[model samples]
Target: MNRRDVLAAGLLLPAILGADTGQERSTFRIGLTPVFLDDQVEFLKRWRQYLERRLEAPVQFVQRASYREVTELVLHGELDVAWLCGYPYALNADRLRLLAVPLVEGRPLYRSYILVWDEDLTSRSLTDLEGRIFAFSDPLSNSGHLFPQYVLSMLDLRPEEFFRRTFFTWSHRHVVEAVAVGLAQAGAVDGFVWEMLNRLHPEITRRTRVIERSPEFAFPPLVTSIHLAPDRYALLARVFLGMHADAQGRDLLTELGLSGFAKGDRSDYDEILFMAEELQRA
Candidate 1:
């Protein structure tokens, strides 16, 4: 109901949904980070169908409201593969292997956007929004929470000390809705999600304006437990890298607003790793 309640419920969600408990699974499990799931349920269904056919294996979708739950599943081996933001991937870099990275506008980079009500021209910057109720998408999200917190740290301020109150909406769309409908005075959300929403739901997006944008960083990537077999990993990588060339896969990518997938390595996320370190120090 409130920020504390929302956080408590989010922490308990995996258990509430009877999430997998580090058990070995036979099916090819693909866990979504839950950013796009709430917005594109039908598109996800179609994408899953394409993956199932290409992988030639039974695929199951594992999801949770917050990235934390799904990250835990991937770390514990409950999920064979997962789509996670750069922040979480860097947080558990030792335990996860890069699978593929989405190419947005033919580049494996995206930004974090600070959003405020469109008519509120008075608050054009982060400092201007001090003491305002702010919404973050998720604690483990790069665009939603980490980058904004980093911004505050740079200002020599902590979130609790800067904002009147801050809350996690658990999803980027919720962050958009909260600011759009005036539940929150300002919010931080993924730039990609914000743009997609602007295109798909202008009625709601019309109410918000981007007050600031963080520098570009590596996009969220598909990942797997480090223990996944090398051969299986190769197969999965091949499928993703070739998706843009395959007719069915290309169509799915179009529906998903993706250019294609590119092979990603640890070096691609060095900036995110640095941000993680900075946040820890803050």
Candidate 2:
């Protein structure tokens, strides 16, 4: 599996949310979830290039359609690294390695917003969408699907058993746009992505309002192939965790709107693993 296969494969799955890192290889190819259009993705390529210069290696930014594809890339060794959501990380933890991740507003967590069209009739709880069409950012998204579904299960309601229909928007911005455009009655989106989108395209995202927010979640983290050497993995992690203190690295963080990078561990994804397992058994 290479870059082409990664993008060719549709990736609609549950994913954990949170973070990025400075992990690198001599000639690394990495993937980012296709939440951004091409132009916005090009803007992110600069971050990979900056890390390349510091690591003294060439880095290729692989364009991928889904977090599941990114996870598959790492697992298959087609991609040396990835910045994937948390649920996907848990799903493929056996084939991946954690490098480093972002710390936002001094924490390593991110949030998910349960959203609805401004024109939607009164409803305050998750169950309000029951028997109605619902949209999720991606199948692998934490709050978007995994946690939200997990919440529904906690309430003795399953999405497939409750909602009339459920669709995957594939991107956080799409979740906002879908609900706003009335393509979906309601959905879950990354809280940070919602803020970013609203800031970037106010008229569009503003048409929708957040009806609820899930408990705080860890943002996507930079993960690598399980095959990567421990020394290289440690070096990669160090470069990222130290980014906030370095001039060029700090600039990259500023561009991504992240405060800095931080150390992370497997404990970071325990809940993701738990929910995934719970869902499978049900």
Candidate 3:
């Protein structure tokens, strides 16, 4: 199908493709959140079909509106695997096994971008926007929420006290939208999402400009519950790690703005964990 046709099909296919029919006991379920996937319905359908073909098992992509919901489902073993933010993964590490991390520009690292409207040339840093409205993607998001919060904490200021008002846009794209349209004076968003949107939807990104970029942190990762069978987990990991080697898989990765997947090290998230720990103490 052409891109337009695929996008249309994606909007209409969720009920038919993503719902649990209660018939496939062997289905390998993977969870997602708008933090990454956003509205790429066609991409999800294509990736699901690719995974089903590779694993020789039925594959299902379960999507939730927020990272907290996806993380809770994965922790309760309701989902076989999930693409999760580094903060949530660190918060529940003992119950999850790192499955794979996506490579962005060939590195498994990304940053948090603090943004302002393109016309707002005077605001160069977060302090410049103090007492102005702010947008946060999700409470559990590392780059969107934690990193921004950590910045405030380091300055000995609290979000409620620093900003006149703050709100959650629930997704990184919306955070950008909130800032671009003047709904918020500033927003914290995932750098990967911002870059991807700049590539695919520049009209929206052109209205906003990134003012600050945080230190590199491990990118969001795909994780499986520790309760999963060893063989099943290995199979899932192998399929992901081998994506770049296969033509069709490589195409899917490109469409998804990824370089492929790596059997990522758990230690990669230590910085996120340390930030979380420090926040708890504060």
- Each candidate's clash count: 0, 17, 0
- For model 1, the superposed segments whose C-alpha errors exceed 4 Å read 1-26
Please provide, for model 2 over 110-214, each residue's C-alpha lDDT reduced to its tens digit, 9 standing for 90 to 100: 887888898876978677888877898888888778878988888888888888899998888888888998888888888877877776679988788787887
Between prediction 1 and prediction 2, the one with superior lDDT is 1
- lDDT string for model 3 (20-86, tens) is 4543667998999985466788888899999998999999988889999999999898998999999
TM-score of each: 0.89, 0.85, 0.91
What's the TM for model 3?
0.91
How far residue 1's Cα lies from its native spot in candidate 3, in Å, is 56
The lDDT values for all models are 0.87, 0.79, 0.91
Residue 128's lDDT in candidate 3: 84
The candidate, 1 or 3, that scores higher on TM-score is 3
TM-score ranking from best to worst? 3, 1, 2
Q: For model 1, what is the C-alpha lDDT against the true structure?
A: 0.87
